[model samples]
Target: MRLSTLVYMHKNMEKMEPLLYDVIVVGGGISGLSAAARLKQFHVKSLVIEAASIMGGRMRTHQETNLELGAQWIHGGVNANSLYNYAIQKGVLNKENKIQEDSEKGIFFYTSTGRMIDLETSQKAWEIHERIVDESENYPKGGNGVQISLKSYYEKQAKEKLKELRQVAKNKTFSGEYESDLDYDEEDLKLAMDALIIQFEAYCGDTLDEAGVAVYGTSQELPGGDVPFPSGTSSVIRELEKEIDERVMNTKVTRIEWKDDSYFISTEERPEAYRAKHVILTVPLGVLQKKSITIEPPLGVAKETAIANLRPGRISKVFLHFNEPFWIPGEGDIIFLWTKKEMEQGVKSKDWTTRVSSIHELESCPNWMVMWVSGDAAVIVDSIDDEQVLKGATRILRRFTGDPGISVPDKILRHPWLADPLTLGTWSYPSIHSKHQDYYELMRAMPSPENPRLLLAGEHVHPQYWSFMHGARLSGLEQADKIIKYMGKMKPKQNGISAAK
Candidate 1:
């Protein structure tokens, strides 16, 4: 009766049920849901089996509001117009909001020594980030097209910039003692500056040095490109689920065994098995990495390696509700902490682990402060208690505002994607030192076998759009098209029913 008991029962799915569906989808996240919904467009019969109770795998909508647990924003803009705009057109997104494009506001610079600096220095860092991407465009050897880690590459470039900084200070006609301090070798200063930039890793979930350049290099770029959230991101999925729930099997799938002609899906909640002609695996990279579900004949080596090696972006979201807005009177952009040590060691100690205690100033939330925890900072925070996380974040806010006695947050909402069993980590990120080719290879879509029985569709599988919600949507539609083509190849069986339906 219980989920655990059913899991260990070791039932054979093939013996429980005969063919019952045209297609059975494993993992009812965005990809699975989207694929199943698209099947409806073609008047195909399908069922979705989810490990979790509800659908929308990572795109979880808060019960009370428009907030999303996993994906919060439409990262790639006009590029996302097809996917995002469709969501709006279909009433999945109520209204689209656009903010000013200039980085002039809500951008601040900090030194490794903990001194706040002007925006000019920050702009230089942004420029360097661009250079890192540009530099990665060329590669030495042919390999899997993956995003190489940018940390080392960026650190090298950052050193050059830091050297230039010192040079400028020394050349000042009225140079003071501070100029003398800037005379240190670029290597020494670069190391310090590298620590400051590690704070940005908090947004990506890995130290810059460990982050792959390949993953970040292919990002869509545009001047004043708009960033949009689903007014409430959670609602989009809720809207999507409304059309698919009638057929979704809202439970955990332990094993799927396919014999010559049909595939069998077994769930713990029910002893009955569901058989289908085809199965669409919409599981996220995180879930695949966890080995949560077993597939007969196993997924191929390429897909398995991708499932294991493609590091899920280590991201966590912390929402702090305040009684009243206190810090950054009118700022709307999120403030970042530029520090020397990486996130793991930056704001953590024995008293707080997985505590992203510093880096405040959210331009998005007028009165509320949200912490976008990534990389080591996210890992550190996941290790601690909620109370500690709350205290640590508050302390950072207080310090940033130059107000040591900042009031405690009214409510603290944290999503531990790393710790969650269903979601082992956040979306995909580049593996350590891996190249862009490797990532692209992972993104390359593959149809099932010589006949195309099984299909792979998800954000991770979408080369250019991987990691974004738009990527997930595109993969879904693409898989649907492939399925349609595959179905066309088969002639109607001489029997009573269609081969698939």
Candidate 2:
């Protein structure tokens, strides 16, 4: 029978043959897969139901360039990440080809006027950034201070400490930090403001004005810097696939009805409901906020409130392929620190991506130029007409490079995570109204009266590590351990025969 037909047909589940599973994991993304992978170690039977035919969710690789459309890097040092450890143990990653960026690559910088800023100017920027981050770390609750955006806080602080910041940049020597300095000058404040705002827009997936001061740098950075995989993030996805026992692809779940200590999961692909002892609900926060999956009796107040309160980061990436390198050559660092002229024009277009954050000329692929955009700008690029997008992209590229001879890219690739209904956004971020404990509230779920059985695990739920892939991975393993421990306390059925087997 076709999936659509099965979805509409309401048959008597009692008459149908029961498809039972020990643990049924929904949404076979990194979180769900990691949960199942850990279950394998316990010799626990598991089934993964994925809506998409392909297993990897946000970790998609672009076909033409082989660049990651979603997660591009391991975001970890040599051996600290367990996900990387899994890939290495499974012979997925090539150790010799690992990539990391540093000042050794000779970082490049440019201004709205296409003029390069002195290293001192960029250093001042980093110092200002440190001040903002320090403030965020110190103030976990935004309500403690007069409620305001990170942008406002930055402006107020930058104005007060402008002279001190200038002196620090000129006098203090940062050994090898490549962060573009926050320039403070009557002549150069535009350069600094544009740079600062773009970083917030790209990183937070919202205007700097909307992002909360408390959650500015709340997401914990792992020990090691980012580890970009030339081979793509799929290698790690493939390595983890071996651990799954059974999986159903193209199965879109509509509802999860729990009654009498068992779950009845309905999907678009199957007529009969799938029975499971416990479920690992690992869908993205956006999906939950939309109520994509209808829970029988509804979740707790804390969890439900969190689903409504937290904001999902809607971001996009645009890859432009050129015939050749058009910018200045031999500059090892692929970064271009230039903001567009329209930004200084004192007009804010609905098209927020007027200033592209970083234009990268990757070492592995020199012919391709990559750019990252977040928030409304990314949405503008995705939703606008192709001609408009081309015109905007061309203007930004030409203005920054100071090369009017630069022609349009031969091909363009876009990572439209927001457009994807399943994902809905790039990641989760704390909005201005958020409480620090909101993530923990979302993480806590109950299978029954006071038991932590129907657990929630995802990067969005991890307070310290919410936006990172490593956080999602760690949350999955954590949930799996909870289930394992829960199961150990209960004896096996008298028959010792699962309904599926």
Candidate 3:
């Protein structure tokens, strides 16, 4: 009976559909969907093919409480403003939908010895770090464009600045200014670097080496910005999906064939030809890194070089939901743990004793803190089994709270962005050794003389805002405009041919 049932199912499989579209979008992420929505506004019929079942690509929200997994806060919302705001202007984000920005009050400071320190001292240390960065970068409060790669210049400048600062620490010079300066030795600087390594890894779920250092640019290259979140980034995605007349979710595009001035896209879920006059490739840099999709005749040398050279980063978020807040008490809450060992070795009991919170309110809520693992730390965390990662995080929290009796959280939310087949990484990070701008031209490449339909857009292409959400949104808008312009030029010709016929 089982054999007969299998035979009947195989024999009755549905036939494939050969659907052609005005434009074929290869990804369903923020950029792709945003572009598709704009295309619809231009009265262009579009098709979006996504490998995942849900939309909003990396701008993910959890199912249980709708907490954001991919992009939580509206970083730079007031300044850059989230793209979701534009969607809201067009009736996307509703009245009830809002973004929350709270202040952090419960401040704790810890040391390498696992001893809690005075909050005033930690603030002083951070202030010193900020001042040094400001001096080294020649930071302008007016926000003028000071183009320099901060990482490269700051590290180089650290030698001289640290030397001078050390003298000030010994001599007690510049009382008001030098008081906050951390009297860090060479070893202390290394410790700070290790801490930063963990911080960046948690931010982008990438490795330190894989992280990019923007060189030849001013301090503004990686200038500090506000945290921004879309009013309803996910809702905007759903709305945009509606714009595409035809969309195939859970369909992984594996190959692209170009001939006769047209593009053919094929997917594993459906064995058929999906043709398009033009193709907009919005896949993340990581997807292309995996070589998941085969391009017939291959992308040109320049484009291929850029695609192959600039690799994507692996990033993910691990969210732990506790029953109540235990350690901190107010808005804008943050806890910084000063430890000697790497984050992956697991948060030691001693390390947590030094945990300090900037937000007092955090103590009132569930004893929960979201530790962002990025760079090398991200690689380590993501590579481990889920249970092990959770246990490690729990141990860290218990140690920080000095609560050995603390129990595991009620819920654990984690996004396997690196494990995701479609999105191989969380976001793009500029490599420390390579010049990312060199590959910028490839990202901007359009199909040549014979076929001018192929185009590329993503966060990596945005030199200034490469790893940022704003960069992705901006790239989508730019590409959409280019495609629209290209189509406008073809419209008259099409009309003329019709009249002749």
List, residue by residue over 222-242, the lDDT tens digit for candidate 2.
665667665678777776787
Question: What TM-score does structure 1 among the candidates reach?
Answer: 0.80
Better of 1 and 3 by TM-score: 1
- lDDT score, candidate 1, position 215: 52
lDDT of 1 by residue, 383-459 (tens): 67788878876666655555566788877766688887777777776565444455455544443334656667777
lDDT of 3: 0.58
The RMSD (Cα, Å) of candidate 2 is 6.5
Once model 2 is optimally superposed onto the true structure by TM-score, how far is the C-alpha of residue 204 displaced, in angstroms? 3.0
Model 3 segments more than 4 A misplaced: 1-17, 78-84, 91-107, 131-161, 173-197, 200-205, 215-232, 331-368, 449-451, 489-501
Count of clashes in candidate 2: 3
- The ten-residue window of minimal lDDT in model 2 covers 177-186
Q: For each candidate, what is the lDDT?
A: 0.61, 0.69, 0.58
lDDT of 2 at 129: 53
Best by the lDDT measure: 2
Report the Cα lDDT for residue 392, model 2. 71
The segments of candidate 1 whose C-alpha lies over 4 angstroms from its true place after superposition are: 1-19, 63-65, 92-96, 102-104, 109-115, 118-148, 167-192, 214-216, 219-224, 270-272, 332-365, 432-449, 489-501
